[model samples]
Target: MAVERFPVEASHIMMFARSVGDPNPIYHDEDYAKGAEPGGIIAPPTFVQASSQYDPDAALRPKPGQPWFGSGREPSGTPRGGGGGGGGTGLHAEQHFEYHRHLHPGDVLSAKTRPGKSWEREGRRAGKLKFSETITEYFDQNGELVITARSVGVQTERVVEQA
Candidate 1:
């Protein structure tokens, strides 16, 4: 619903690596990473995409009284609608990423994210559903661009009918 920006630090990358159970020395060992094929310990591509400091609140979440379509519950008692209203179901439709350069420790990164596209569709069982796509850009401390990511989300108002 709102566009937000934030800075990324090396710790974020390290934490993400640890959380994902990636023991690649490149992610943790500076010397090992420096010796990697690219000449510098580069963060995993997936790590870069997953590494960010954006707040969940900045992104759209389901509101109260809404069906549990997998997005999240609203603090209030009203079913929150996403970008569009086909009922309140949500799903991760797609993700696309592009990397300009690799992220390293001590690199200060910044990101700006916003809802890019949205639409509704009819499901075999869920009836009608709404979905939104979000795009985020990551930039290095020097103002150089590093990576760009696009994530798709599907949402619906009612539970999908069982077959």
Candidate 2:
């Protein structure tokens, strides 16, 4: 997978804040943000993670007859998707983040995402399953690393039995 970077404009931060229902003045009011504890208008922690902006056409998908291309099957038996079911199961297993500094308007942001690790394991009911871990790094216009995020998703061939 290739890494994608996006510029962070004030509009993006404000739109994200509104979409997430965060009413903090700092996220909306420039004056209030400048006076806040952080010293400048900053995006909410969750806002940073929500900025997974990417080109819709640039997403990775399997080609035709490519062993279930887009079917969420990696050589292993893991399912990948938000549904958490066999053949098409995927879920956000976990998320970890680290922030070196807050992002402000006009800060060009770029992200590089790649497969970090993957494996298969036995599920209590589904028998065996596969999962993949991905790491995405965000950098500022200056090429300075600003944030790092790791996301995990489970891919299986069977429906994910509810716990």
Candidate 1: stretches off by over 4 Å: 1-8, 48-89, 160-163
Best-fitting candidate, scored by lDDT: 2
lDDT tens string, model 2, 1-163?
3446566667778889899888888887888877889777787786556554543334344435444333344564334335544444555678888898888877777788888899888878555667789898888889999988888877665665678
TM-score of 2: 0.72
Models 1 onward score TM values of: 0.66, 0.72
The lDDT of each candidate is 0.66, 0.71
Instruction: Locate the minimum summed-lDDT window of 10 residues in model 1.
Output: 51-60
- Those runs of model 2 whose alpha carbons end farther than 4 Å from true positions after fitting are 1-3, 56-87, 125-127
What is the per-residue lDDT of model 1 for residues 83-119, given as tens digits with 9 covering 90 to 100?
A: 4454445667788889888777667666777779888
